[model samples]
Target: MKKIFSFNNIKTLLAVLLLCMGSAACKKLIEIPNPVDRLTPKDVFKDSAGAVLAIEGVYLNFGYYELSQGAIFNGVMTMQTGLLSDELLTSSADNTFVDFANNTLRSDNNAVASVWSSAYTNLYVVNACIEGINNSTGISEKNKQQFIGELKVVRAFYYFNLINVFGPVPLIKGTDFRVNATIPRTPVNEVYQQIVADLTEARQLLQPAYPTTGRERPNLHTATALLAKVYLYQQNWSGAETMAKEVLGAGIYNLETDLNNVFVAGSKEAIWQLSTIKSQLYQTVEANDVIPMFPFMIPKYYLSTHLLDAFESKDQRKTKWTAVSTMDIDGVLTDFYYPFKYKNNTAAATPREDYMVFRLGEQYLILAEALARQGKLGEAQPYLTEVRVRSGLDEITPATQPAFLNAIMKERRTELFCEWSNRWFDLKRNGTVNEVIGAIKPEWQSTDALYPIPLGERRLNTFLEQNPGYTE
Candidate 1:
């Protein structure tokens, strides 16, 4: 049989397999014939170009409507979680935003299902890439390691998000559909261990410089930055501090002096970003989703009053990162604010902004928090100061450890809001979710910290357990 090895063909194969795996009848559907004339992994990897294209296919999955820029991972989850916490509030009749903003999310929510399915679907592609790259005899050893390293980083990224959102998600590291179809949730701690291991190996395997010219591809520093965050979440302060400092010391990135330019394409602050090149439908999905085209138009969501009040009067981020408008509510003209970090929403052929996954601003906060946790308050001051000074705020001088940590948490809340689940995760990790969010949202419960596992997923796989406080 003649073997076909092409980029489009490989992408189609991966997409079909992922679609099958994401279906309710995944087991039966996934048994369908492999595309490319049932080409073995060897045949696909035999051509170095095909192997590279296979990995690029994984990146394409990152930009999928359900995954990165769309409503699931980077866009929706970030916005809704902001609403769930305190960064945003519902302004429209969309039930999904209304449900999340009101702290009344259901397991059957389509947004919830999309996040769960898309994350795993992309993860399946990552595992497939790792397996094919490792088993390929045609590829050089160096090329194999590079591909495997990048895939490991992507896998760790998905697991990190999964564990954070669902508490203990099933850790699927292999491409065995039979086993993955029924895998149960792994312990949260165990999941962190796997993340650390993957990131550590990835950091070692990747080069200091990014593999690609842009920040879209993972590098040693990219792995280090993520690993630092993993360590921070795990309370491994020394590990977190060490890894964070390594990235900073590399001199590859710097805090973008102009706060407004941080999210622009080719930013100096970007450690890892997702290119919108593959997303032809929208130039910047997160921007187009959150920001309204006209000043008076009500956006799908708006910045919460709580977040608006959190910023100091002179803080540049409030002015530079958010947009203010006045809209008629009933007969009264009311003022509203929405996140404007991504300023461009036009559907131009070349994107003006990139969805930032990791950046120097986050690293600065990560290092500061890690240092503060280790009781190095004085040492942590400079890193925190760097971010604050850039935000046009004066340096803070907290007298005590608790005060310093609180400052770091507050800084994270303001600096990272609406970018990802930064505010939500910071609140959860700092053990102030109930005290902070509950005070603002009366419906806030401790159990609300973990989103409900999608109802459809529970029905499809009997082994999957529902999160507490959600219907099984």
Candidate 2:
């Protein structure tokens, strides 16, 4: 078992806040680390620079863990969920990925625990930052509000993934560990209510333009785009259409004509991206893990045949977004396919991709699906066709609402494949988990739609209940 750390201590909060700073004080802070030693939150938030570092620390913690190490930003959701959803296949039998591919996850599974623990760890940091920002007198009211808004939106992002994967999770909106440790899981709808509230207020607090260089930080449009996705998941079609249209019409982003350039840093297609100074040499985790380094080198994870078969004929995505390589397995030459969306694996002076979080391409699909769900087939046709035309596929003009909805789902599966577990979440949202996964795996069960709540968490908080179909 991995060593479990408690966030109940004020010292724990200070250590995480300081150690994650990634600045000159990081080494100094770590040297004095002691669980029994306590530091007041005011000591850290006493100045504006400290306040800024507190927030940056949250992002640094995200960057500290890469895809191979289970970073929440792109790793666990994009890869583990991909394996569970049939979008990816594990190449070796010795790895933990086989459990995900086989859909036999347990509460004790380390990867499952990693996703749960990592999210809560970040959440604690974000919540502490929000509280510190509010209490700090050194920061201007304007900056404090903006900082709180940013933290809230980040908190929403964490909860969004937790609620989606775990079904229901304890909503820890504050940094009080005593209260947090015993809180029962909040209902999915209530958790979403908090997410909507966070994003809605964040949109009002954030400026139209990004706060920092590039599109790394969440901006006004970023909140709107995420809210649109939230509404779509809730089946609020009109709300989804309104929010999605706001992003699509903002004139800030454009659909990249060239598929190869979409994932590049600062691309107009990106709504929100995350960058790591530490990864300046590695470029991106997607490239490092998916691309083979040498001839006959097999990738650890590759695209599944199920995902490859979903693409239409002559589709530009199938050709441009995927790549093929050869390897020798048991002395027999074998061909393998993998995602090549971000194609830089070797060390370089400058990085190419920033790990896309939200992009304009998804907004187009959201708008198309929302409009179609509302029976506005003709109005939705152009939005749907916009994505298709860029992919070198013929413009789709589905005559019926059902046909348009079906078309949108297919496009979503192909366009958003291996992205943020879109395919896994889509199957659950569309109520097709049983129908789709059952046909593929004979051992599939309806309850397998939701992963088991980590057993460590259950041991920590007795109020927590496990998702069905897992042994206690």
- Model 1 stretches astray by more than 4 angstroms: 1-35, 64-73, 349-351
Error of 1 at 458 (Å): 1.2
Best by lDDT: 2
Candidate 2: misplaced stretches above 4 Å? 1-5, 8-13, 18-38, 64-68, 328-333, 349-351
> Each candidate: what lDDT?
0.79, 0.81
Error of 2 at 58 (Å): 0.6
lDDT tens per residue, model 2, 327-361: 77789888788888877775462436767989999
Predict model 2's lDDT versus the native. 0.81
Cα error of candidate 2 at position 225, Å: 0.8
Q: For model 1, how big is the CA root-mean-square deviation? A: 5.6
* lDDT (C-alpha) at residue 13 in model 1: 49
- TM-score (all chains, Cα) for each model: 0.91, 0.93
Say which candidate scores most in TM-score. 2
User: Alpha carbon lDDT of residue 350, candidate 1?
Assistant: 43
